[model samples]
Target: MSHLQAHAQSATKSAVRPEHGNDVSPHRFCVAPMLDWTDRHERYFLRLLSRHARLYTEMVTTGALLHGDVKRHLQFNAAEHPVALQLGGSEPDALAHCAELAEKWGYDEINLNVGCPSDRVQSGKFGACLMAEPELVADCVRAMRAATAVPVTVKSRIGIDDKDSDEFLQRFVAVVADAGCRTFIVHARIAVLQGLSPKQNRDIPPLNYPRVQRLKQRFPELQIIINGGINTLAQAQALTDGSDGIALDGVMMGREAYHNPYTLAHADQQLFAEDSAVPSRADVMAAYLPYVEAQLAQGTLLQHMTRHILGLYKGQNGGRLFRRHLSENAFRKNAGISVLKDACALADTHASLPPHEQPDDNLRNHA
Candidate 1:
């Protein structure tokens, strides 16, 4: 069967639950919900590279789903199976309604965003600020739980602003867990709500993996997945490998997965113990071509899909040549799948020759 066919057929299949002891859980290696980076096209592309990793949508606000174009926010390619929809907003009724909508649309899971620290999210009284109002977050979780059969989960920080303590995190998680949330993906840092920009909040704040580890020890029943500051394969493996008895359930990678997605090509074998050999860079490009071609035929910009694969050849021999060709031509009116074809041609040539021995003209002299 074709990739598209598998994409369609797998849409209805359920992903393994991300619980400790359920090592079969596909959520062991997830690509986090990055605002613009994990849209449908990007999810579909990433799916080609690792079939086992769970993918998440860019956070769709409750207002966008209820008051704006619902289909536009909720619709996804059939191939992005085991995909979760991350919903933003604090209104219990609105979030519950959106959760119901997500279930109706066949989403595999619904994740509540209590982790974002942006001023925009603060103005709306949700995100990390909700960390201070554990009851309100619990109510939201209760309502969403009442609305869907699929798992209702949350992504949050260890704390926010003045509440950066283990006692504070314990209270917050206890209340939300009381409301029936079993899984919590915690970014192991505090959100500096007042002076810092969201980007600064991501950095500057020291990562406290030990706090998360203590939380796991405190609430062993909860599937606690760690997020934040984990950027490389070795770092990701340390947690997911489960060798140290850390008791954490999973790993949710954001920017690392986006900026260097090729790292995920090995996620299936490492995280899920899949028997298949890891995919080659060329193999991923070849598998993704049909999806890109189909999207382009549907009037989607070539760059819309191609942009996500720019890192496909990252750190490889002829990667610059591949990136230069796609970067230069993908947005052109006449640019088609041929841009990828030519890029792959360069990728293959460089894959064979030593970097110093390879002709410089190949990357610099793209035809």
Candidate 2:
């Protein structure tokens, strides 16, 4: 293996979950709620990598739960324990109703999404727009907390537009905390609403982690999770060392999980320090194969699922061959687990390929 890959693998094996000084559960690492990116299949894949880290479902709108197929939207694997359902809404009654339904669906926690800055969300009068109305957010949190016994939490950007100030954030937290929400996942950045798109909002916003740390210091009783632009295991570990936890989204969940899955395997060993063996990409593909076939039988496109696995062999000896073979063959009519076997075979055969030829660039960019 290349030196960087070797170091990553070694770090995975040595990762340790730090003990928090507070009364919260020890699952300090969390997968952030990403729209369309953190479905059940992705959550299950992440669960295979780290058993103890908390997983969050994508933001399900309160309207969807109240009017749409709530069960299908909330469906998840049994193995994905300690999972939280993130709900998006501004209405206190609707949010409370959705939280009740999520609690009934057996989620470990109910999180409020106040961080998403999409225009569509703003038109719906929710997401980061709620940041402008702390009173409304507190009412929603209060109602949800009263409706469900599960821990009610909020995920928000540091500020929106000109409202970016410590005073705004402090009052926002204080209002919600009074409403019984104790956990706050702060995406430590100010979101620009006018010129930036939602994707740019995630990237262009300057990360102000110290502001989040200050929030933690100010409200020692609140569990503050830092999120935004944290891409490496080292970064995750370092952030969690100071904060209550670290929340990772597209950067870690999609790109990193696909490019260097071994990081997760390393996280299992180093963070959890559990002797449990990391499953090979082949093993993961084998396990997921039957599920894919079943979904296909029901007319689901392979792309829906395969898109989540494109980075499975990132940074490995035959990473490109593995990704290329799978990318080409996985969509064939009636493709099965045997396709994964072929991909693995390609990896084995091209193990001696130079690093430049092994698709690490694709892995890194996507990751």
Candidate 3:
């Protein structure tokens, strides 16, 4: 059986039901909800790499749904199933309304964005700053749960700024969970909202996996999945299998997955145990080309889709040439499917050569 087919078959057998409902969570392996990175096209591309990794949409604020283009923000390919929509806002009523829209749009889960440290998110009274106001977050969760049958989840930091303590985190989780949130995707770093930039916040804060592990131990009933600094499959396996003592639920990978998406190629078999042949980089692009063509026919710019695949050949031979070909050509006025095909040809050509015969390019070392 193909890995994707096997995953479909074994999904029910591997599901872990929470105390509240029979809904099987796709939380075991998830890709973080990055602001501009996890869009519909990107999610569809990643889906071709791994069928079991739960995908999340980039955060859509209540204001966007309430006033802006709703179809643009909520519409997604049905193939991207087990997908979640990450909403950014603090108002309970607005959140509830958006939650209803999420259900109407057929999203599998509704995740509140409580972990973004951007200045924009703070000005709007949402994101990581909400960790300090647990009661308000609980109200948001309560209202959202009432609006839809889909799972209402939260993705928050360990703590925010000075409130960076175990007790503070415990209180935040306790309050939100009390309002019907069962799964928590915790970024192990506290958001330094005062002096750091959002990019700095993702890197500067030292990761505290043990703190998150303790969170699972403290609230044994909640499904606690740890995020932040998880870069490898070995690391992902260690956390989920609890090799270090307390096994939480799962691991959410961010930048690593984006820069080297092929890392997820073995996730279905290794992480979910749906054993089958892993798809090669060529196999992935071959499957994705048809989707690219369809999107292009629908007026989507080729650059928007091509940019996501630039990192698909990150470490392989001719990877630099592949990126260069796309980066230089895909932005042209009439760029089409042939641009992608040519880029793939560059990667495939150099990949078949001996190491010594390959072109002398070391830029990937710095990339």
Candidate 4:
């Protein structure tokens, strides 16, 4: 078998149903769907790191799927199995159609996006704004569940704006759960619909992890996965295993997973209890080169895929050189795998230098 196939099978081994007889959720260790970030190329790269961590597509709106290029929005590498397609729309019929499309396109799950606080999303009458209208959200969920056999999940903030009350969240979850949605990925911050930019909304709102845990406490049967501010594999493990008083069903890591992509290198072993050997950073790069080459031949721009790997060596020796080399050269016309090789070589070379012998900013600039 090819090394990639071997990695996939190895990860799947640990995903088997446990002795407890409860189905292990793919949600247990998910990488949050960030717009313009978690595309097919990035998902493919992440799969090489951990076979079992669930991946999500960026929010594709019903309008985009119905009127836009269907293939561009739906096509993905088969290696990204166990991946979900997150949809952005509140109209029941539109969402129902989208959910049907998602299942037909081979998505393992269909997630409704009710937590994004972006103005663009709000103007569409979807996203975190839906938090205020529990009944409408329920209708959307009901329609989606009717149209697709794949699990229909919802991702929402705990509350939105002045509706930041525990009772409000409870009512919302209860309504949606009654409508056949079994999983709710809660970003444990009250989305301030009016004052915050989308970027600010992610950070400015203080995280109410306790509130999410309490949500789980109230509805113990429904799968409740916590999102927002979780940064490391250790944190993901702790939250899912109930390191605190309440054991959540899962944890979703966002920017940290992207900016420090290698954080997932140990997920299969650490989170899924897999016994397979972990791939080193060098090993991951080597495995990914062939993919990059294939994409390059298929007319994908080298920069599109290379941009995702800039964080592969993040915080390691020679990491800056690795990033700098790619940032400087990957965008050049006709750039190919050679540029990536040179970047990896620079990282290796700088890491081999003695601490005192390593180049400073000035020397690195010239190098």
Off by over 4 Å in 2: 1-27, 243-260, 273-275, 297-299, 352-367
Error of 3 at 68 (Å): 0.3
User: What digit string (tens of lDDT, one per residue) describes model 2 on residues 1-367?
Assistant: 4332332234335432233334333445677777777888777666656666678888999989899998789987566676889999999999989988988888888999898889999989988989999999999999998898988999898999999999899999999899988888888888887789998998887888778877877888777777777667677666656433432221223245544555565665544555666666565655566566666787777667776776777766877766776777778887766676666677765667776665553443321
Q: Which segments of model 1 are wrong by more than 4 Å?
A: 1-21, 241-245, 361-364
Q: For model 1, how does the per-residue alpha-carbon lDDT over 1-367 read when each residue is reduced to its tens digit?
A: 5553354345525432223235555567789999879999999888777777789999999999888999889998766777999999999999999999999998888999999999999998888898988899999999999988979999999998888899999999999999999999999999999999999999999999989988989998888898998886567777766564575778888898887888988877677776677777777777778777887888888988888888888888878888888888898986899888998998788877875776675445766
Q: What is the C-alpha lDDT of each candidate?
A: 0.84, 0.73, 0.88, 0.88
Where does candidate 3 have its weakest 10-residue lDDT segment?
Answer: 15-24
**Cα error of candidate 1 at position 103, Å:** 0.5
Clashing pairs in 2: 12-266, 13-266, 14-270, 15-270, 15-271, 16-270, 16-271, 17-271, 255-367, 258-311
Which whole-number lDDT from 0 to 100 does residue 335 have in model 1?
84
Candidate 4 residue 51 C-alpha distance from true site, Å = 0.6
After superposition on all CA atoms, what RMSD does each candidate show versus the true structure?
2.7, 6.9, 4.4, 2.8
Point out where model 3 deviates above 4 Å: 1-25, 360-367
2 against 3, candidate with superior TM-score: 3
Candidate maximizing TM-score: 4
Q: Best to worst by TM-score, what's the order?
A: 4, 1, 3, 2
Global Cα lDDT for candidate 2: 0.73
Better candidate number, 1 or 3, judged by TM-score: 1
As a TM-score, model 4 comes out at 0.94
